[model samples]
Target: DMNDIPPVFTTVPRPITLDDDVPIGTTVINLVAQDSDGTSPNNQ
Candidate 1:
């Protein structure tokens, strides 16, 4: 939910999936990320 820092981390497919046994079409996941620099990597 942020665009102010370097993308040091990433998530595959933009979205992931749960319900390993049965995917009933109502599955969900969390696309997460974190920056090496919390405030600003560019020192802005």
Candidate 2:
């Protein structure tokens, strides 16, 4: 639909406190985005 909404962040990462000695390549958090449209391309 032309009025289709944009993808939203279904899973947002939370703030975290890391030590100064933490590894440089350490992963902080993960995020997820989802589209409500039920059609192809748009759903991706």
Candidate 3:
């Protein structure tokens, strides 16, 4: 059966604190999302 399952956030970023002199372009955290459908386009 083909079912459309919505993507879920497998990894969620936690609250972060930045200093006043933080860089303009800085990566705070990384997030991960997964789809249960396990198919192209939808999975991605």
Highest-lDDT candidate: 2
Cα lDDT of candidate 3 equals 0.78
Q: Which ten contiguous residues of candidate 2 have the minimum total lDDT?
A: 1-10
Q: Once superposed on the true structure, which residue ranges of model 2 sit more than 4 Å away at CA?
A: 1-6, 35-44
lDDT (tens digit, per residue) of candidate 3 on 5-41: 8878988768988899989888878899777886676
lDDT (Cα, tens digit) per residue for candidate 2, span 1-44 = 45388989988767889999999989878789888888877787
* Ranking 1 against 2 by TM-score, winner: 2
**Who is ahead in TM-score, 2 or 3?**
3
Q: Model 1 residue 32 lDDT?
A: 57
Best by TM-score: 3
Q: How well does each candidate superpose onto the true structure, as a TM-score?
A: 0.27, 0.50, 0.55
lDDT scores in order: 0.54, 0.82, 0.78
lDDT of 1 by residue, 1-44 (tens): 34466655467646555556775765476565656544543432
